[model samples]
Target: MTQTPSSSGREGGRSLKTRVKTARKRSLSSTLWLARQLNDPYVARAKREGLRSRAAYKLIEIDERWHFLKPGQRVVDLGAAPGGWSQVAARAVGAEAGRGRVLGIDLLEMEPLPGVEFKVMDFLEAEAPRQLMEWLGGKADVVLSDMAANATGHKKTDHLRIIGLVELAADFACEVLAEGGSFLAKVIQGGTEHELLARLKREFAVVRHVKPQASRADSAELYVLATGFRGAPGA
Candidate 1:
């Protein structure tokens, strides 16, 4: 059985946090990460509730506040590996009943999910737009990108990489979103995305950054939401 983290597990009538014993082969970072996961409420909740990942809660919380995902909304989930956000999208959009469409694209192979179409492809490739359009069958009502580049350990480089990925996602959203659509993407907190923000403002009626509670307090990650797309020409 999977270990469940709870206050009920106690020693001497006092609750204690779960700790991972460091193995000879385990790095300190690996040990700490395991310990954190073992203690995280979202991790336990995801397992209990049958969500694919804890990351699903981040998208759920954001949409709850923003009211983006809805019935009959065609959704595109870029970098949708592990199928967490796609699961939420399917349920929200009623895709299983054919009320809307949900398509997920990622370079990584993902197990199939009901009501969501999965494709293994790199979103940066030239054919990506065409393929996603074919799956969507028309302009999307919502575009979601939880994609992040691998961390390089250097703060500046990592931030720049995520920003670049977000920029690409935003550009793709602009190309394929219907008027009044919404775009949501992950971006790190920093000064780098000012130009991206300016461009989004020109194309979207509102652009804002939201940090979901599911995100660790120490993480610099934030989601950028752009709503009411203006449908730029040539896009």
Candidate 2:
């Protein structure tokens, strides 16, 4: 992997851009994405810091502001491929110190990380919540989802698809989060639907949107954070 340039994509007062030549088999979009990854400071930083992926910084930034993910807490990370969020959670919650526990679930198998247990299964499966709780030995203190649907060219359709994912993740969080726990999930610029936002407000004491600096300026991705979960009705 190429070493990351400075945050400004410059070094020693010289601008640097990693350009990718289009391969015969590679599409223009793929070439552009490769180039962007090569030039992204966060990507280089992640490599230098020995982190799993760039997504780790997003969680780290949010947690730094909120001071969530305390020691001895339990955390759940949905769609935790490459284990970036899981890595951050494990460290913040002191999982390596055996003070906390982290569970990472995804359809794709993760290479594995200390202090984190990876489960290769669809989080959308009917029994996923139950199984996750069983693995964690109880409810989680924080539930995170960085999952995003593959975008179609249609903007509205892409927004709806991501909202649908957030709704499902919120529902799952409610099922498995302990009282006063937190839930965070990825959403986009169009924002979450009214019904879902209203529901989150009712379920959690604080619900708001946050976009970390690690997220690209041109990208519409943002996160919805709901803290102080109030347990199920009549529980």
Candidate 3:
């Protein structure tokens, strides 16, 4: 990872923009991505603060604004590989050792964290939700999904895939969230999300979109938060 620096005014000061030299084996896109990651303040902050990913700050910012994830709340983190949001939930709900519990599910293995039970399983699997609920001991007070399908570099296909993932997450959340619970998921910037917002409005008292400062300005990612779940339609 070679870095080329620009003019700076202060001691050890460097331009926010980091430039990387491309190697024979690395594509220009990958090199650019590496350069961005290297210069991202949130990435550096995550390391200093002992968080798993810079994405953790996005959760922190949203929760701080909305005042959700209280102590003793049962929380579920879907597609929780890397376990950044799981860590935040565990701390918020006092899950280190108490009534509050956090369960995380993902297809990828995650390193263990205090007070978080992580299962390497696909949430789309038929039996996964039941297992997660059993670990939580009851319905969840909050459900979070940072899940996204691997980008295929085709904007249209990528948007559809993420929307589908969010819809699946919403369905799972509605089934397992206690009345008055909350749901939050990452979504791409696009038109299809309107339908999702409408569906959520039917079941939640408040629904809103949030773009945390942690999200790269150039990225088209945002989070949709719905709170005060009104319970299943027939319940």
5-41, model 2: which lDDT tens digit per residue?
3467767988788889999999999999999999888
Candidate 2 clashes: the total is: 0
Clashing pairs in 3: none
Reference-based TM-score of each model: 0.93, 0.95, 0.92
Error of 3 at 218 (Å): 0.4
Per-residue alpha-carbon lDDT of model 1 for 1-235, expressed as tens digits? 1223333455797767787899999999999999998887878888978889888989888888888899999999998999999998998899989898899989899998889999898878887877777777888999999999998899999999999989999888888899999999999999999999999999999999999888988999999999999986875
Better of 2 and 3 by lDDT: 2
- RMSD of every candidate to native, in Å, equals 3.5, 2.8, 4.5
RMSD of 2: 2.8
User: Candidate 1 versus the native: TM-score?
Assistant: 0.93
The whole-model lDDT of each prediction reads 0.88, 0.90, 0.88
Per-residue lDDT over 1-235 for candidate 3, one digit per residue giving the tens place of the 0 to 100 score: 0111122323556445666899999999999889888877778778877889988889988988888899999999998989999998999899997758998988888999998998888778788778777877778999999999899989999999999999999999998999999999999998988889999999899999999877888999999999999998786
Candidate 2, residue 202: the lDDT equals: 99
